[model samples]
Target chain A: MSQELKQTPLHALHAELGAKFVPFAGYDMPVQYPAGILKEHIQTRAGAGLFDVSHMGQVRLTAPGADAALERLVPGDIAALSPGEMRYTMFTNDRGGVLDDLMVTRRAGDIFMVVNAGCKTEDLVLLRAALGDAHVEYDEDRALLALQGPGAAAALARHAPGIAGLGFMKAATVAIGGTEAWVSRSGYTGEDGFEISLPGDAAEAVARLLLGEPEVAAVGLGARDSLRLEAGLCLYGNDLTPDITPIEAGLTWTISKRRREAGGFRGDAIIKAQIADGPSRRRVGIKPAGRAPARAHTAVVGPDGAVVGEITSGGFGPSVDGPVAMGYVTRGCAKAGTEIELDIRGKRHAAAVVKLPFTPHRYAK
Target chain B: MSDVRFTKDHEWVRLEGDTATIGISEYAQEQLGDVVFIELPTVGADVEAGGDAAVVESVKAASEVYSPVSGRIIEVNDDLEATPGLVNESAEDEGWFWRMELSDPDELEELMTAKDYKAFLEGLD
Candidate 1:
């Protein structure tokens, strides 16, 4: 095993809390705390849970015409994104395939972006190589922490007043516990929450303060996976790979009407055709019949025992009280009520296509 | 009740005349985390020693529970249907998975005694 795993700003804190540390996205992250996965999942749903996501990359794109330069990569209407608002968008390859899905926010000062931890290095290299001279800055010394659940709003209000009034998808530069932070009302868990981006030096102090609260607990990567799976969010390597297109990932709404009409982004020609004519395969949600959870790479079988599709993500959803899965199926079989079978270890398990997320999102409007 | 024996794969068998009770060892349940599902063999089904006889799924991973000694499955612990966590809570006692009639009493020689199994566990770490 390679002992050269990357460390987060709160690596010591995780160890102090007796967390089961594991390597994730190049960083040595906590897989679970002593509270266990079940308790952590329930705690995040009921109260507030803090997560250290400092490994995710933060970059700014600045050029003579940055909007036009940035539009060359993604299909979303980036120029139209208002100040203090964040948009979820994807970067595409030349073949209309999604390289990665990321959050882009136009700050009062600059055009800030947050990409997946695993793809951040590649994204930076690609962005810089594509722009040539477009002054792009990678803020590698910044740390991100998410305070999520129903109690998140109240928790933020105590430290940073007026943040409670911020609506979903809104971003504001605020001082959290006297530390300068960019607090955005965005999360991957499909819950009401805020992600605080602060200086790496000040991250430990803020995380420690949050952990002192009775309503707040430190959650780990294990519960994070389960929560995002229940929310129908896409994991970069699994759901949004180089071979999968945004259209097939069931993320058509992220593409704006203006961008759809005037194609200027990379792979626009293929993506536009996919939006109009539909992709060969479509992502669909699956509900398994038995307790056996359909895991990733499980083959999807058609009526006559022929392989039709493959599961990208699947697990026992803690909130759904049963097993749920997401996979790519033939276009016609992506309907919400279509019947399918998942071959788990040669046994075909009955399943039905359903609309994600497996659990309803409770974002604050 | 006859003396119990264990396998390196973490299976335990307690012999009672021709019938024997089988379950996963306490250490196996702990390593698997929380038990989510238990797929038991049907009663009266014949199974071979060291053969795959059951499936045990935890929240983290899935494992196969092999028959320590060949036998005919007499009965399954149906409580696992509604309460799979019982295996985690009581791996060696009330959570016994199945009872079976021994196919060959001599096959029990392949299993390790409790004292020997404890020494094996220490060597593993």
Candidate 2:
């Protein structure tokens, strides 16, 4: 029997907007609205796009030493995180592979974390087993929304004043639609945006309020995936997996200087060694030769016609007006401008290694 | 107007004498959203009835367009290579995927007529 799919708090609203639903992370989530993925993607780059990301897991950990306790799990310098600061890090396993990537925010009295929907159950189990005294509170009562693009701030500022002042990677409690919500100036789309975590009961009201803005259109997972792909952001299961390490994924930067020197997190030794003598393979941005997209699982071919790597995330980038993809390749072939061949369905297509963020990041600094 | 027949896979065949013009239905294109790329079977390629003959790719996913009747491809849509979105704009007319010489005209009898196809679509909802 097929498993019953879950619905987000904004499901009714999405249906009202004529969103096409698809199964993702066990949820019947909207993949695109009537405007379609291409238009939604371009709209997010040009104007404001509102997204219902409530399927993502949200939790709050409270303890006297929550920051230090959290540091023992991930390589990020959570202990140094001041209140209202958010850091992106991954849960590394003993073998140095990434279990999942998550966002850790230092709230006033606790650490607020948002994990991938597919990994939430496993993450909670791991966190509960590892965090001895820290109280892990699953905030299922809340919903997450992302307002992104060039015009996002202007549209959001009308609802919550002073939100535009919060710098990138910063978080603050703001009143949105007359309800308290945690607003963070960070997003996966590489656009100027804010992620608002609010009460589930108030989600629909605030969503409608945001959609009421002329600049804000409802964007779905289809555009969300394309937007993040263009931004070069890694999706949890695709670009990252149990077999991929932060070092191999080119996410070592998330391992801060202090965290690198202290070396106490899980798989620290393996990660340290990989950092010292670069990883065998690294994730790099790929641009195919022509209009035909090289999708995920497409083999990366070397000069000798040997399979060297495989595309993890890929599709037609509406904004780029061409095919953009990301994949893991031997370190030697990971450099920008390196010529590679993508074998799509028994045919080889010419491609090149390029710097990430296929489109320039337009974060609000 | 020539008699148009549709297959369960959403491909449409417009029969005229010994040749038939094939393309996906407008409903199929609307369901697939914006078409980005399409790969058509080469001319002179023999395709079996109800077999894959073309691929239509949208920004979201790729779908195979099946041949409605056994035939040898006489003409393939080359314009789709540069302007695949034409399929979304005119799926039944200018967006025809190919023209084929019917190997067995009796195969057309197995397909659904326009009225039956319309009822089939309604039943799907």
Candidate 3:
């Protein structure tokens, strides 16, 4: 027997907008709207685009020792985090592999965490085992929404004035449409914007209010992919995974110096060794030579027919107007401008390893 | 009169005289979503029936374009490179992938006719 899937607050609204709904992360999600992926991507880059990310898991960690309890799971220096500041961190398994990546914010002695929907169940179980005395509460009734793009700040400022003052990687509790919400000055898209966490019941009302702004347009997962691709942000399942380390995924910067030396979190020994010795394979950018797009699992080969690596994420980047991809290549060949070959359909297509991301990220600082 | 035939892989070929123009069916395009990139075979290339001849990529997924019949590629629609969405806009007509000079017309017998293809699509659902 199978359980019925969950629905986001915007499921009915997505239907009314004629969005193409698909199953994702145990919930029915909108993949694209009638305006389509290309237009939606370009629109978000130009103006404000709204996303219903309610499928993400929102949780609160409490008790006097909540901060210390979380530090046992993640590699970040959580105890050092200032109030209102949010940090991107990851949970590691005993083998030093990434269990999940998440955002944790210090909120009035307690900690607020938001993690991937797919990893929430396992994350909670792991947290319980590690911090048996701590209070771990999952707010399943809360909904997450992202209002992103260059115009996002202005549009959101109309409803929540203080949100405009929050810098990137910051969080604040604000009032929007007479309802309370936790707004964070952070986004998956490299754009400067806010992610609002509100009551599930009022999420639709908040979404409608944001969309009423002429500059704000509804964006789906389709556009979200392109935007994050252009931003060089990692998609959890594709770019970062339980088997992949943050260092190998070109995310070494996310690991702090204090955590790297102290080494208290799970998998710290193996992860610290990887940091010291460097990963054998490194993620690099691939620009296809021709019109054909290089897709995931396509072999990345050297000149002498030696398989160097395999593509993890590949697509036609609307912003760059060509085919771009990212894959793990041998560390020596991962340098920018190293010409490689992509085995796309049995024939070798010319490709070159370059610095990611394929497109320049424009985040309003 | 032209006979419309389809392959199980979703490619449709319209045969007129000895020339067969091939493209994916409208239903195929709908399933694939908006096409972002189309890899067309170069003219004068030899292609075998049931062989991989091209690649079609949408924002969501990528699919191989299989040849419905064996032939030499005579012409390909260059417009698809600039506007791949044409495959979704008008898959059967303006979005036709290429025209080939048939190496063996007998291969058409293995393909499904319009009535058979309509039934094939129905069984798929």
CA lDDT of each prediction against the hidden true structure: 0.87, 0.91, 0.87
True contacts kept of 2: 0.50
lDDT score at residue B23, model 2, on the 0-100 scale? 96
Which is the leading candidate under DockQ? Answer: 2
Q: For residues A103-196, could you state the per-residue lDDT of candidate 2 as single tens digits?
A: 9999888999999999999998888877753488889879999999999999999989968589999999999869999999999898999999
Chain B TM-scores of the candidates:
0.97, 0.97, 0.97
Q: For model 3, what is the error of residue A202's alpha carbon versus the real structure, in angstroms, after optimal superposition?
A: 0.6
lDDT of 1 by residue, B1-125 (tens): 37899999999999887889999999998677667788899899999999999999765557899999998999999999888889988999888899999879899988999999999999996
Candidate with better TM-score, 1 vs 3:
3
Q: lDDT per residue, candidate 1, A1-365, as tens digits? A: 46688888889989999888878887899888877776787788999889888989988877656767888899888899888989999999988888888999887667889999989888988889877635789989999999999888887788888596788999998888899899999898889999999999899999988888888999988788878888999999998898888998989899999999898888889889999999989888888988887888999987666788999988777778678889899987888888889998888899988899988899999
The digit string of per-residue lDDT tens for model 3 on A1-365 reads 16677999889998898898888888989998888888888888789899999999998888777888889898888888899999998898787778889999999867999999999999889877776635888899999999988899899989888776688888999999898999898888777788999999999999999999988989999888877876677778877778888888877787789889998988888889989998888888889988778878899997667999998888878888878888888887888888899998788999998777666665556
Candidate 1 DockQ vs. native: 0.43
Model 2 lDDT, residue A314, Cα: 92
Best by lDDT: 2
Ranking by TM-score: 2, 3, 1
TM of chain B vs. native, candidate 2: 0.97
